[model samples]
Target: MWLILNIVVVFWMLIGVLCLQVPPSEFWPAGFVAFSLPVPLVLNFLFLIYWALRRSWLLVLPFAGLILGWTYYARLFAINLGQEIPKEAKTLQVLSFNTHIFNAYDGKQRTASGVSEEMVDWIATHPADVFCLQEFYNNRNTGGYNTAKRIGVRHNKEMYFSIGEFGRKYGDIGIAIFSKHPIIDKGAIHFTKKESINRGVWADIVLEGDTIRIYAVHLQSMSIRAADIENTYSAIGNEESFKKESRNLARRLKRGFIARAVQVEQLLEHVRKSPYPVIVCGDFNDIPFSYTYNQLAAELQNSFVQAGNGIGSTYNGILPFLRIDNQFHSEGLKAYNYETHYEMGLSDHFPISATYVLEPKPEEER
Candidate 1:
């Protein structure tokens, strides 16, 4: 019985490993399956402990599973002991946050909120060279708060946005880049998929001696409606409603997975054509183990996996364990001192920041 159970557990872990390689388009279930990558790791650890307590050599099964799935585990969590902070001349601090429209729109109702003011104040205190915001609202004078302008003024940086299709109805809905450096060039990649938030924007900023292209992207969200969420929590224990909400949530997740896959292909193409060194940051709206994340990770270095320690979860929703927000950079740059600024809970997502520096060119190149 023990052998049979352990074998099943090991096989499940292997399936999780396969999820890393399989694209969502090839097998849609893989998209949903990848989210449970951490589960197998935790279960294997517990099984290893169970076998060890019994002084059984069968512990090798779960141990080998851990060894095999180590890369996925490493991506989820890191322990950095000797990570050092960069010096003033070398350091470039960048921040990425999804403001969730400052929590201003609740369903059909749109009312003013102090969330934007508080976020501006927060940014003022914890300064960064560049601020990349998704679901940014910019309503000047009409709704009483122009978030982008306010943040730009507070930080004294120029702001660029990928204005959404909704236009100014809910405040220029889109992604924005606020940079302290002088932006020489800027553009936006308007996604074909019709999502209000799915868009990418880039700004070429002139630093000390080189140009750095910063991309602010907001991928397809899991379009789980407020009613779906509220029903999930409020109507718990009611089996019929619970199952209905769960199904809707799952459908949204699957759609988001496929949509993000398409969006990432566009993002990768844009990254490939970049003339300057690149730093891409934003709310991915997906987990670390998903196909969307793996595609991006293949092209660039992930800042959190490089410099962050422990579980660097950034999403502040019911399941706060999801690190949907990420920071990635091109090969020419190095990221250090990555952190999730959980101090201000003004939005559904937490802000993440990282200090980066240009890698010294090889002697022959110079």
Candidate 2:
């Protein structure tokens, strides 16, 4: 039994290693296996405890697995205890949040006023040099809930937005970026798919004589409907119904993973060729361990990993452990005092912010 368990441990570690690299785009099975990387890490810890209780030599296998996949562990969670908080005039504070289309309009959680009111109030008070919002809504009705324009008017900032594929007709729900500095240029890169809500928008903002390109992206979502979630939960004990619901859920997730892979490649290429240093922020809708995050974050410094504490989960949903929203910056910039604001309950995702400073250029360049 011990030998069999050890063999299973080896195979699990192999799967983790395979997942660290990109999976074949044409194969769903590989993507499915890649998605299971998080599960093996949990199992390894459980197996380590079991072996310790038995006082068995088999404990070495799981320990080795953990060591082999240390990169994934580091990215998923961190403890930046006692790290110095840098405060300087060069520091730029940035906030990124997915408003979930201001859930007050959802008709389910209808508050006394609405989420839009709370969000607008928060933005006015909690100051940041730049704000990137995903799933943003600009309803013309009810006197137009134009968040970007409203916030810009109140704060005196430049605002730019890219309406999603669906938003083109509905005229709401897209990605928006607001900056205190002057916006020299702005544009959006729409994904190839006709139905994909995923799109990326870039703004070249001039800050203190330096021009930085900021990309606000909303990647492909799983598109799991409320009805699908309800059906899956309600059919838990019914095997046939549960199986059908599970298949539908898995299909949506698989398609999202594949589509994001394609979308991110193009975005990364554009970022790589940018003339100015880049800061990428938005709801990736994918976990840190996934290929989407790994690809897009190639050389960029993840703000959470740099300064955030605890598990640093930005998601406010069933699985609170997931950190789908992120902020990444190129080498010239340093992230400090990263925070995930769990206090904001207006949306399914908590807001994340960080202070950043641009490193001085080399004397030779001057």
Candidate 3:
């Protein structure tokens, strides 16, 4: 019986690893399986321990499963010994955050009057050389807070703001990129869905002697409200209510997976054609184990895996372990001091920042 259970667990672990390779567009269920990978990972570890204690050959099954999924494990957790950046290297500090519209709305209602201003002040004072903000808000109305104006003034940087269709309909809120370096060019990747609040924007900035493109992206969100979570939790004891709530949540997740699959393909198309080295920063709205992260990581280096320590979870909502925010860079750059700013609790998502230095060109290439 124990061996049978161990075999099942190992099979489940393999499926979780397979989820990384399968596109959610091709198989939506793979997204959900990938999101729950941590569960099987823990279970397989336990089985490995159990079999090893008994000196049973069964240990090999769990061991092989873990070895197969090691890359995904590293994506979710890291233990870097740390490295020193050379003092002479010119570094660029980049910060990516989903501001949740600066806490303007708490659920369906507006938050306290002064809350948005306070959050804006905190961000404006932060010392990052470039800021990639999702759910960024800007208003030009009299007496309204103009977030871009405030932060741009503080950084004194060239700014690019792309207001999506949804942002245009609901108070000029979208994604923004602000850089201390001069922006030589700027553009946006408009998703096929016209009403999507999520979008991608980029700026080509000349830093030191080279030009690098910075991409700020916000992918499709699950649209799972706090109320949906609350309802699901409250309905736990009642089987019928629980089933209904679970279905509702699952439907939202499915929609998000499908939408983001399409959206990411659009973003990748832009990424592949870029003439300059790229640094992508944003709220991906999907875990590192999903297709979205894998597709990007295939082409770029993930900063968290390179420089971060521990399970670098960036979401600060009801979900406990979610590292949906990320910074990915081309091989020409090296990332250092990647941090998830848990200290700043002003938004549903915490801000993440990293320092990067361009790699020295090879003598042959030079």
Candidate 4:
């Protein structure tokens, strides 16, 4: 019986590793299994310790499973002692956050008057040179709700707001990029699906003498609200209700996975063709184990994996393990002091920031 259970656990571990390579487009069930990756990974580690203590050869099985999915493990956890940035280093501080529309609406109604203002104030005071915000709100007619104007005016930075169809009908709300440096060129990457409020916006900013591209992206969301999660928990005793809630949750997640796969492909094409070194930042809305992350990580270096410590979970919802936000940069840049701002829990997602310095050009290129 023990041996049978060991085989089953090993098989589950294998599925998690395979999910990274096979996208949801090819096999939709892979999307559902991706979220369970961390569970199997932890179980395998425990099994290894158990077998080792018993002096059993079964330890090799769990050990092999760990090695097979080592990359996923590395991406999920970091243990850096933290590096010091030189005072004279020409560093560019960049922040990426999902503002959840500045927490303006609680369900159908507007939140308290000062709620959004408090969030905006925290962002304005942050010392980041570049801010890439997702689910950003800006109301042109209303002076108090003009978030873009408030932040840009306070920091004296240039702003680019990518207002979508939803934002146009309802007061403006979408993704935005605010830069302290001069924005030389700017554009938006619209997904093939016209209805998606999610977007990718890019800017070419002249930093000192060199030009660098910054891509601020917000991908397709799972659409799982806090109420939906609460309902799932509440229906635990009733099997029928539990099944209904679970299916609804699964359907939302599956749709998000499929949509984000197509969106990431579109964004990658634009990223590969960039003329300047690029730093991509935003709320990915998918974990590091998913296809969205692997595709981007292939082309760029993940800031958290390089410089951050611990799990670096960025989601501020009931689901504590989701590190769906990220910052990825091209080889021409070096990342330092990557951090997730957990204390400022004003939105559904915590803001993540990192400091970067341009790599020196080769003598021939100079």
Pick the lDDT winner.
4
- The local lDDT score (0 to 100) that residue 170 gets in candidate 2 is 38
Q: Give the per-residue lDDT digits (tens) of candidate 1, residues 98-140.
A: 8888776775676555446777667655679988988887777
Q: Give one digit per residue, the lDDT tens place, for model 4 in 1-366.
A: 665666788899787767867778778898878767888888878888988999999899889988987877888898767488766556789999999888777668643343478889899889999999998887765777778888997679999888874443346667899999999999999986574558899999988888899999999898998889999999999999999999999999999999899889999999999999999999889999888998999889999998899999999988887899999999889899999999889898999999998876797247
Candidate 2 on 288-365: residue-level lDDT in tens? Answer: 867788876676888898888888888776655889999999988888889999888778889999888887789724
- TM-score for all models, in order of appearance: 0.91, 0.89, 0.93, 0.93
Looking at model 3, the pairs that clash are none
Query: Model 3, 248-361: lDDT tens per residue?
Result: 999999998888888888999999999998999999998887888888999899999999999999988887888999999997899999999998888989999999998777
Candidate 3 Cα errors over 4 Å, as ranges: 106-115, 142-144, 165-171, 193-195, 364-366
Cand. 3 Cα-lDDT: 0.85
lDDT (Cα) of model 2 = 0.78
lDDT of 4 at 23: 77
User: Which stretch of 10 consecutive residues in model 1 shows the poorest summed lDDT?
Assistant: 164-173
Worst 10 residues of 4 by lDDT: 164-173
User: Which residue pairs overlap in candidate 2's backbone?
Assistant: none
Give the count of colliding residue pairs in each prediction. 0, 0, 0, 0
Error of 1 at 121 (Å): 1.8
Q: Candidate 1, clashing residue pairs?
A: none
Of 2 and 3, the candidate ranking higher by lDDT: 3
